[model samples]
Target: MGKVWCVGISPTDPRLVGIEGVTFHSTVNGCDTLLVATNKNGLGGISALEDNVLIMHESLATATAKGLHRMVVLGDTSSLEGRRWKVHAESWDSTMGVSVNSIHGMGQLIVEVLARSAALKGMQVILIRVGLATERNINRHLARAFTHSSVRLESFKDSKIPDLDAWTAMCLDESGEFNSEISSEQWAPSRED
Candidate 1:
């Protein structure tokens, strides 16, 4: 089975680890929201969040080049003017409490970068929005941001927030390579807290 990466705020959701093809990766660390502004010159904020997103894009791109064919992103979504979408990242500094950063051109940048990678074609990318009681429209708007990209996009709003097993099942089912034998407990935490 191809390697699958679980990325986002809590990418290492315990349920997702130990699965045969799943691995956890974090792009940001205590920030509650990762807001991607709609316009190029939208409200400007700190570069820390934007930098983290770029790093994420780079990591995924490199992994794609290395034959990673599946990805599951866990986060909440938000949109501006009903056009652009944003994702949550880990806190840049846990000591500072939760922070909010407004990044312009995030949607376009995500698409443009990922779409440029020939290795990402046919990749199964799943965006699992983790909040339940919030609005769902933003999720769709966020999902649409990648509509024209090379990768196959699937977005779901999980109110109850599923575990690693459910996420792995979704990725494997999408990739048509589910293996029932691999136990979720077989994998250990790879990142330090």
Candidate 2:
């Protein structure tokens, strides 16, 4: 099958590794994100995506609010490799503390995990942060993807968390040839203390 890919840039960790085909370029996003491929064609017409590509999940970029939202799915780059997106939601617990909701919120911690996934498990984790015109636009799409049934909530240790405040919101990370999917479901807030 043909391969579709994300064509963007990142100063923190820029470089599409492992993927069989990919042409590079630059962008202005300062944060890590898990971008749902609404359209590989929308990927800005890179040479790699000019051929056979598999359509995974909804694209947060191209998909219309009425369109992609209907599907209620953001992205699903899952593949044979262990690279996968364990979708989860955000929640707070008395004993465990605050649980991170999305991988995007994980930031560099997510990057560390993806690197480990590729090296140790031999799989890639798809990452994307919506770099639209404004934060409002980005949050709109995130808000939709966040609540999708696919996403769920889980627990994480404080040691692994780089900065809970860093993720005052949600986002995504990783790219290249790897299996990554969106984590959705409990995108709501908890009144618990």
Candidate 3:
């Protein structure tokens, strides 16, 4: 509902050639208006004195979380073009297919969801701290299943996610109760698990 100035990726990028108010820049800048799509790196360009709201996009998984394993999380990290994670025997024999590869970019999915919601509410700056705070608890529980308590979570951004989904899989057990048991299945192939 506001006069939103859409910026181009670059002047030569061709997205802003004839657009009335569009401008191009390497980084997000020149706005007293609310900020959106700024990531960790772009945070540097923000002015504290401005009344802008920052809608950032961060990955739920990054290269650090990449590797082979018995079962790889079907996400951006393990799916990078150069990466390859063969299915573990248990998962493969149980499920279908031979291997898993990445195609759809999943890295920034977390913030994208948040950003989309913010955009829906009208180009306002959306503040998201849930993924930021929930990371430790998630890493502590899931990673600890394979590695020690010191496997400090890297840039993986799903920290804001609630604990219910993974720990409390809705899949009913044989007796039709909520599955509340820890899985022995390794989620990712890691160096030390």
In lDDT terms, which candidate is top?
1
Better of 1 and 2 by lDDT: 1
- Ten residues in a row with the worst lDDT in model 2? 71-80
Ranking 1 against 2 by TM-score, winner: 1
- Higher TM-score: candidate 1 or 3? 1
Question: Residue-wise lDDT of candidate 2 within 95-133, one digit each (tens)?
Answer: 222233333223223333332233233221222332222
Whole-model lDDT per candidate: 0.32, 0.27, 0.25
How do these models rank on TM-score, best leading? 1, 3, 2
Query: For all the candidates, what are their Cα RMSDs to the real structure?
Result: 15.7, 17.2, 19.5
lDDT of 3 at 143: 28
Question: What's the lDDT of the predicted structure labeled candidate 3?
Answer: 0.25
Q: What clash count goes with each model?
A: 9, 29, 8
Candidate 1 Cα deviation (angstroms), residue 10:
6.1
